[model samples]
Target: MKLKLNQLDILLEVAAQGSIGKAAKALNLTQPAISKTIQEMEAEIGLPILQRSSRGVTLNEYGQVLLRHARDIDRSLHQAREEIDHLLGKAMRQLRVGFTSAASYGPFTNTMIEFQARYPGVKLVAMEGRPHQILDALQNQRLDIAVLTAGTSIVQSGMYYEPLYALSNTIIAGDQHPITHTTSLKSLMNYPWLDWDEPGEHSILAQVFRRYNLPQPQNIVHCSSPWVMARMMEQADMVSMWTSVRLRFPGYNVNLRPLALREVLPATSIGVLCPNIGRLSTAGNTFLEMLRINARDWLQQSDAAEMVARV
Candidate 1:
C-alpha cells in the first residue's frame, strides 16, 4: 500500500512494452528518468526486475509475480474510481455486445441463456458482424464486448483479448465419396469440393489453398450454413471443412467421412475482447468471467479430435 503508483505504472509499461525506451516514450518520460525509477523500484523490491539481452528485456520470474500483484493493486484503484464516478451518476448500466460467427461452433445460445439469467437487471444489446467489422465497432465505441476467433490473431488498438477456447478444423466428405484414407493435398483436389460461397479473399483457409497451388476446389453448389453444407454432403461427391467440435456434437445429423491429412490442423483460437482504456462496467466484467468459466467447463465435457485445416 505504501508503494508509489507512478513507479508501479512505469514498471508495468516497461514490462509490457519489453523495452524501457519504448515504455518511457509511452509514458512521456525521458529514458534516464525511466531507468532511474526502475533501479529504485528494484532496490525497494530487493531483486532484479528484468533480464537484458539482444532480444530485448523480459520480466524476471520474481518481477512477473510482483506484476500480478501490481495489476490487482491497480484494479482496486480503478474500482475506487468507478465508485466515485457512480456517486456522480456518470456510470453506465448497459452492455453492448458484438461478435462474429462460426455457425458450426454455436454455443452462444447456452452462453446467452446463462448471462441473462445471472444479470437480469442489466440492459443487453447484441450485434453480429464479421471479425474485422466487430473489432472496428469496438474501437469506435459502438460495442462493449466481443467474442471472435482468429489464428495467431493480434489484439488491435484499444482492446484487450482474453482467449476463450480453440476450435480445430476437420475435412469431411459424403459417405459415398471415394477417398476416405489420408489424402494428400494433391489427391483430395481430384474431386470437386462442396464449398462455402464467400468471395475469393485473403483468409487463413485461402492462404492454405494458395500455398498448396490448388485452384479453389470446383464446387457443384455453395452454401454458408454448415448444416446446409452437412446435408449437401450426404450424397454429393464433394468435401468440406468443419470444426472438429461441431462435427462431434452428440446426435449431430451429418453423415460425412473424415479425411486424413499429413499434419495436425492448426486451431482457431477464440477470445473475449473488451475496451482496455476506460472504466469497466460491472456487467462487462461479469460477462467476461462468464465466457471464460463457461468455455472452460465446456472443454471438460468433450473429447476433441484434431482437424484438417491449418493456418
Candidate 2:
C-alpha cells in the first residue's frame, strides 16, 4: 500500500532488464538484495509481480499495471527536478517534440525558429517519425507534443488536436520520370508506385484508385521514411503522393515535381497533438502558441494565392 520511490525504481529496473541479477548489476546492488526488494514489494502488494524462467523474467499482470504507473511517476519526478533546476538557474529548460516528416516544412519549421529566438534558454529536441510513431511517443510521455497529418482514424482519444492547415495533396515523381507528363491515374499504373504507410485499411493513393473503380497499382512499395522515399523517387521512376507544402521544400522541389494529374486528391490537414489534461509545461505552451500564429499566417497566404490563381 505504501510503496516507496526506491521500490518503484527497482521495479522499473527489473522490468526493463528482465532479470533480477541484471537489475542488481544495473542498480549497483547484490543479486540477493534485488531479490529481497522484489519479495518485499510482492508481499506488500499481496500478489506476485514477476514470472521467472530460464529465459530471464517477465512482468505478470499486476506488475504490468504497476509498471505503467511507475513510469508516470518517474517522468513526473524528472519534470519536477527540471522545473526546480530552471527556477534556480542551474539548468536550461527542455522541450521534446515528435513530428511526422510531412509536417516538417514551412509553418512548422518557421514556428520552431521563432520559438527558439523567443526562448533562447530552452533547449528544443525534435524527432522525425511516421504519424503513428509520433502519436505513440506522445501517448507514452516520451514527447511533449506531436505535429502530424490529422486524420480522424489516426488521432486517438485523450489527446487534444488543433487544426493547422489543410494542405493540398498531389502525386509527385522525379522530374525526369517518363510518366511525369501523364494526366490520369489510370495511365500511371504501369509505373511503380511508392506509397507512404498510413494507419488505415488502404493508403490515400489506393483509396483514390478505389474511388474511381480502377484497379490498384500492382507494383507498389510501402515506405515510412520521407528521406528514403525521396531518394528512391529521385533514383527510380516510382511515383508517390505527397503534400504540396512538403514538395515545395528545397531538396524535394529540386528533383521532384507534382504530376499534372486531372484527379483532385483529397486535402490532408496538418495539426498539433498534445495532452488534453494540461500536462504541457510553460515552454511547451509557448511553442504551441507560436505554431498557432504561424499556421494562421500560412493559411491566410495560401488563401490569397488561391484567389490570385483563380483571377
Candidate 3:
C-alpha cells in the first residue's frame, strides 16, 4: 500500500491541530477533502491510523510507527530539493513569517526589523493569528516560521525552535480600577476579569491562576485582539491578565500590578518555531541567526533590566 506525501502532510496537520476543520483551513482544502484523503490513506494501509478525541487528535499505534517513516521521507525529499536549489545557485528572497499579535508587538518585531536592515532585498510575507492558527500555517507550508508561546503542543518531526524572550503575567485593569497599588490576590479577586482562550492560544495568566488554586476572577470579559482588548479596557471596568510584552505597545489604559499569589507566575518564553526545519531557506536561516544573536544581546538584557525595576 502506497500513501501519498500530501496525504501524510494532511494527517500530520490534523494530528497537530487536533481538528480536521483547522487542518482543512490551513491546507486550503475543504473538510471533506482532508478527511477523504486521510480515509483513502487509511484504506491503503488496511488499518486505522488516527483517532479523534475530546483531548484532541491522537495517533494509534500504527499511525505513530508510520509517522516516523513519513517524516524521514519528508526530510529526505526536502534535502533533495535543497540540494537541487543550491546547485542552481538559488538563494531565498521571499520569506513567509507567522506570529501571534503579542509576538509581533514584542521582540518578534525587533527580530524582523533587524533582519530587514541586513537583508533589505528579501520579500517578507507576514501573517498573524492566534497560536494554533500560526502553527497550522507553518505545518501546511504556508509559513516558514511562527512566533508563539514556548512549549506549545504543535509537535512534529524535524521542527526546530528558538527562544526569543520571556514575558510576565500581570492583571491589566483599566485606569478606573480602584486597586492600583494592590498586588495581593485577595484584592484582585474583587473585580471582573477577561481572558482569550482561542485554540492553542494559552495565556501565561491561566497557569498563574491554576498555581494558586484560585477560582476564576469574579467578573469576566473575553477578547481576541489587543486593540479590541484595549478598547474594552477603556470602555469597561475589566481586569484581564496579559503579558507585559503586549502592554508595552501603545495606549492600553491598564493598571498593571503583580497580584501577590502563592508564587510568581512561571513565565513562558516566546519562541520562534519553524514547524518544518528540513525546508529552511537560506534567508530564513540567516534570519534565525540574527534572531538568536538579538535575543542574547539585546532583548534579554533589556527585559532583565525592566524586570529588576518592576520587582
Q: Which predicted model would earn the best lDDT?
A: 2
Question: Lowest summed-lDDT stretch of 10 residues in model 3?
Answer: 253-262
Per-candidate TM-scores read 0.60, 0.64, 0.62
Q: On a 0 to 1 TM-score scale, where does candidate 1 land against the true structure?
A: 0.60
lDDT of 1 at 273: 78
Candidate 2 C-alpha lDDT tens digits along 160-220: 8887766677888887898745489888889998888742543677777887889988898
Residue-by-residue lDDT tens digits, candidate 3, 1-311: 78888988987787778788899999899999988987898889899888888876678898888888888888999999988878533456778888777666545677889888877778988888877677778779999877776545644334787666666666666666565554755567767677776322365455566668876565656567778877776667666766666666666535433333434656656777995566687777777787777666654465545632132
Question: Higher-lDDT candidate among 2 and 3?
Answer: 2
Which residue pairs in candidate 1 have backbone atoms (N, alpha carbon, C) closer than 3 angstroms, thus clashing? Answer: 169-307, 169-308
128-210 per-residue lDDT for model 1 (tens digits): 66566677788788988888764343364446877666777667787888886777656776676654435454145554577
Clash totals in order: 2, 0, 2
Off by over 4 Å in 1: 1-93, 103-110, 152-158, 194-202, 211-215, 218-223, 248-252, 275-280, 304-311
Provide the RMSD of all predictions against the true structure, rounded to 1 decimal.
12.4, 17.3, 17.6
**Global local distance difference test of model 3:** 0.70
Once model 3 is optimally superposed onto the true structure by TM-score, how far is the C-alpha of residue 115 displaced, in angstroms?
2.4
Return the top candidate by TM-score: 2
